[model samples]
Target: MPNKKLTDVEKLAIVQEIEGGHIGINAAVRKFGFSKSTLMKWRNRYRLYGMEGLAIRTCNRSYSAELKLQAVMDYFRGELSQYQIIDKYKISSRTQLADWIKKYNGHSSLRAYNGGKTAMTKGRSTTWQERLDIVLHCLANGQDYSQAADQFKVSYQQVYGWVKKYEAGGPEALRDGRGRKKAPEELTEADQQKLAMRKLEYEVERLRAENVFLKKLQEFQRGRR
Candidate 1:
């Protein structure tokens, strides 16, 4: 069902009906208004781990880098398919496993997954310069908003909004712009020097980001070949 949250009991009932031969997969799909893939997923999970497998995830699950590496190695061993690996590892989804495989094949580092629900309702205050830096950092690191937020100790929404604003209207758009800003000509020699130094620092950071992106791109290309 689209956007439907099926209770554990309901999910069990549906899987039982299908398993007991009371309802065929196609018939269940038609009656329950869920895709065949979803129904099959439920059935397989129920079969593999009983009720526990069918339980809805209340929070995001973290996988250790070691577990990810093992899963990747198992797949490469060719003894099990992706679905089999997922079931064996109790992974949350095919997509999650697929991501690991892709990263592994591309020779990217597989770090422990510690992501979920990091966005805040209220964002903290930031200066225009800080906003610009945050946006630049986010873009440099594959536009990972949550990572940028955590690193900068800002809200995810703030980082995201700043990036979008910067994208649409350059660095000037990041400025609060509500107050009068000093013109370039109005800056003292020391102020100008500081600005120049900051620009140089940002440029170095951007170059590093670009180098990392290029390396990742090359890795993926090599993987495809």
Candidate 2:
């Protein structure tokens, strides 16, 4: 941590006030936030350097995000184990490595982002098929869009939108959606069962991937098998 800025003149005046014949240092601590040890340091510095006693200073700890991420990535690429990376990188915490690896893959190296200078990303909009699945689930249960949004933490507009899309197009509404017109729900109960099964089957794969990551210190294996 960096020291709070203080001027040489202010430090000298404080030193004089502490050393004044009529007052002791404890009274001064009450008037200012300085500790007794800080006052002592000021006194010693003043005696040695006269008016040049105050200057910016830092304590010993420095945490670097880039260095830690690089070490974590190296560990993931089979170059280092979790503990080995910690020792090699002089990382502040072992868990930090685990977290980065879990998030970014086996090689969770830090990548610099010229974030402010970067233009907005294009063509990566949310999938409407994904939207329709959740909306149908809500509608089949007779739940309102607001209630679903609250449960899922999406904006109200989004929740109602899926509801509107599903209402207009039936099952096909939940898709890489087309124009605002309804699509025919020509499928029978057997077909609807197959569609529902597709969603459930995909869900199983997602959970399995999550389980792999949460189980231990291992490389992430995402996607459905």
Evaluated at residue 24, the lDDT of candidate 1 is 100
Q: Pairing residues by index, what is the TM-score of model 1?
A: 0.45
lDDT of 1 by residue, 1-225 (tens): 778889888999999999999999999999999999899888877877799878997775777765676676678668999889988988877778888778766656566758423233236789887887788778867787767877887755577778887787766677786876555576688866866676677678878878888999999999999
Local accuracy of candidate 2 as per-residue lDDT tens digits, 1-225: 226656777777778887775557887777767877677667755554466445443442334434534454367458666656665765434455566556444333233332222111111245655575557556644545445544554533466556776676666666664566343566677867877886676567556756766865343344332
Off by over 4 Å in 1: 114-225
Query: TM-score of each candidate?
Result: 0.45, 0.26
lDDT of 1 at 134: 84
Looking at model 2, report the run of 10 residues with the lowest lDDT sum. 115-124
**On a 0 to 1 TM-score scale, where does candidate 2 land against the true structure?**
0.26
- What's model 1's lDDT at 199? 60
